[model samples]
Target: MGTSGDLPDGFGPTIGTLGEDPLVAGVIERYPSAPWLTVGPGDDAAVLDLSGSRAGALIACTDTIVEGQDFRRDWSTARDIGIKVAAQNFADVAAMGGRPHTLLVSLTTPADVPASWAHELADGLAAECSRAGAVVAGGDVSAGTEIVIVGTALGSLATPSAVLRSGARPGDVVAVTPGSGRSAAGWALLRAGLVSSAFEGLLSEHRAPVPPYPAGVEAALAGATAMIDTSDGLVRDALRIATASSAVLGSSVVLDLDPGALAASDDLLRAASALGVDAAAAAEWVLTGGEDHCLLACFPSPAVVPAAFRVIGSVLAGDSGVGVRLGGKPFDGEGGFRHWS
Candidate 1:
């Protein structure tokens, strides 16, 4: 079978770029790593080594998404689970200001589950990796009660010393990249059926965190002194930076909401009114809800904050406490999400 794009001399697709697709080696093959390996997927494990900089410490992160604890059987599909797992782990890497190079996955599922489900899961993983410009190097499969995903990622750093949480100054410009609190509003809507048309995008955001992975790298490249991903909650993340860098964290609203976020908030406000859910309480959820997977950072120069960076608040010198202020006034309420009260 041949087409216009096919080789007229019988050189099929396989015979073209692959050199020898069916070629089998009786002996074990070996190749040494080089400066220009790019990304070799055929190897047992993909290896990416960043050069030109003096940094040389490997930061590894591993996370597990269980069927019940992380993802509900009724809410998310297998592919969704895989994508979430990868996204969450990558978020952690970004929080540390590292470039994710390779990912390893392990899957455990019930024997009765559809085989296509696992294939789709792999597809989802690959899709996210492609979006993140990484690769699915190797993974394992086993039996389990339900869907479970384990991912281990390798990260490259510009320097061994990274933009940690513990290093904010009293007047450092506190900023965030592409902020969104719609996840919390969407969750409430799903529970109360108060979802409105304006907030549907927020519902999708709640389902999957759309973090700017490159933002971390850019922030670090732009000399971000301290940074953390907004996974646990903004307050919790700010606390981590405050503790790690021995700095106090403070925030003030400094965002011009994008259309999606604006619409979502409006819809949620209406829905909350109908359901008796305190719409203003969204401050609590937005400041603390986990899984949003955004970035909170400190900048030395507020004027030169990265292109996508949004000015949130400032890092102050004070007692180790989380506080919030409104309209240039300090209000009495806590910020961020905390697990178990």
Candidate 2:
């Protein structure tokens, strides 16, 4: 909030229309130190000292959100954007069965934008960090045509081991968090301008995904063989685990799922019904439609699946590609989301 006199010549005097240094300084003044933070917000690089913890390894993930492409300002406020970005970045750490610790953010926006919007964005980031037991360690800001936010989350494994993508084997049970596809269905509703009070839950899910953070750690503790977050769609992410783990054993993996399982979420079905999307189209959204960030894990056995997860399918010996099966037969339809497609 102060002048940028201490900053270099190129930095602006006001926080609203500033160069990188003053913007960084503004962020520093707003956040305080946490117990685990050794150096925060004001150095060549922010530092977090995790040496005191028993974590044998660190998990890190980074993600970016672009205006118009990833989100619309009309659909999401500054705060919602901040929280959504944080949720996505931290969800990666959780997918690896880690406890999120800190986030480094980078923001770029038009010079004319109000400074208050930036503050709200930061507040949203902080709120999500608090929810995930993490902190805003540091970040940078710059000028751009549209709002762009990039967040990197550093986390520590709850246990010495990580629930990696390369752990599943033949006969492993495929499990997922409850209520998949609501975000995708919600997205459809938003596009159709059918957003009403009846679809509020789905709408919220699309805007701000609340991935089960603890479920990743719980899966790790329950001896989960492999895990992935469904940011890229359920089948696509499942294929990642299958592909990675299958390569280790030199055997192909198949994910056998029931369409009913994907359609099981009440909100998803309700939203689908409201829009008359029908059973087949809803199944496609469940399989595809990225950004849900739900955890999909493979347990050694169905019985070992933790309380937070529901067994939707099983891992089987097959070809390298992920095969979706319904009623013991190959299900026919396109599978999952593609970034460049």
In order, what lDDT does every prediction score? 0.62, 0.80
What TM-score fits each model? 0.73, 0.89
Put down candidate 2 lDDT per residue, 266-309, tens digits, no spaces.
66767778888776667777787688899999999888999999
Best by lDDT: 2
How many pairs of residues collide in model 1?
7
Scored by lDDT, model 1 comes in at 0.62
Candidate 2 error regions (>4 Å): 1-22, 29-32, 319-326, 331-335
lDDT of 2 at 159: 78
The residue-by-residue lDDT of candidate 1 on 1-341, one tens digit each, is: 36776546323222123222121110002122234235544546565655644246666789787765556645555566667777877877787778775677877766555544565566667666666766665566666676678998767775556778766666677777664566665666666754456656666666555678888888888888788887776656665666666523343222111222212255556656656767565555666566778888888778767887877776555553333333334433254444345
Off by over 4 Å in 1: 1-57, 193-199, 247-264, 267-276, 320-341
